[model samples]
Target: MADAAPPLQRLKGAMDAILVADVFLVMAGAAWFGVAVLCHSQKIEAPLQLFQTLWEPLFTPAIGLLMAAALLSGLLGWWQRRGQKRAPGTGS
Candidate 1:
């Protein structure tokens, strides 16, 4: 709408981006976890073992940070936009 404020529009875009990133993060983490588990059970080669070994420590923190950041961004964006429907006293 032409009446929409710039800040609210920006917040809405940010919230959408965060939601998409959250979905991608979950999918990637799950895929890596599944691979690690399968490789361990199948007695896979050294590279797979090496990947599993390296992945846990590095990816664990990364995934945590990704999810936390996405959630925080979504919340902050929502909060910023919640009361931003109008500039004060420009009556519709």
Candidate 2:
């Protein structure tokens, strides 16, 4: 039917979802690490070990991917806006 979105729109929507998920994971991991640091500074052990457990498997890759995703999203948005700004008669 005519209700379906274009393929590009669908792809962009999926990319946005991935970007949000990456951002959430990175933020949650960083927050957990912060809490672990505070616990260590106070000579307590609330989530020090748990945070370490997540550092390698979850946090590390998520942090790296989040940076890449953010860069891609920024560039994609910029490219889209710039293209939209261009007109048939404009040349600059």
On residues 28-80, what C-alpha lDDT tens digit does candidate 2 reach at each position? 88888898899999998869988888789988888888888778879989999
lDDT for position 63 in model 2: 85
Estimate the TM-score of every prediction: 0.45, 0.70
Number of clashes recorded per candidate: 0, 0
Question: Among these predicted structures, which one has the highest lDDT?
Answer: 2
Q: Cα miss at 78, model 1 (Å)?
A: 0.8
Question: Which pairs of residues have clashing backbones in candidate 2?
Answer: none
Give the alpha carbon lDDT tens digit for every residue of 1-92 in model 1: 56766998899898678657766766776786678678768876664666568666766666776778778879989888765765464753
Q: Against the unseen true structure, what C-alpha lDDT does each candidate score? A: 0.71, 0.85
lDDT of 1 at 78: 88
Error of 2 at 17 (Å): 1.3
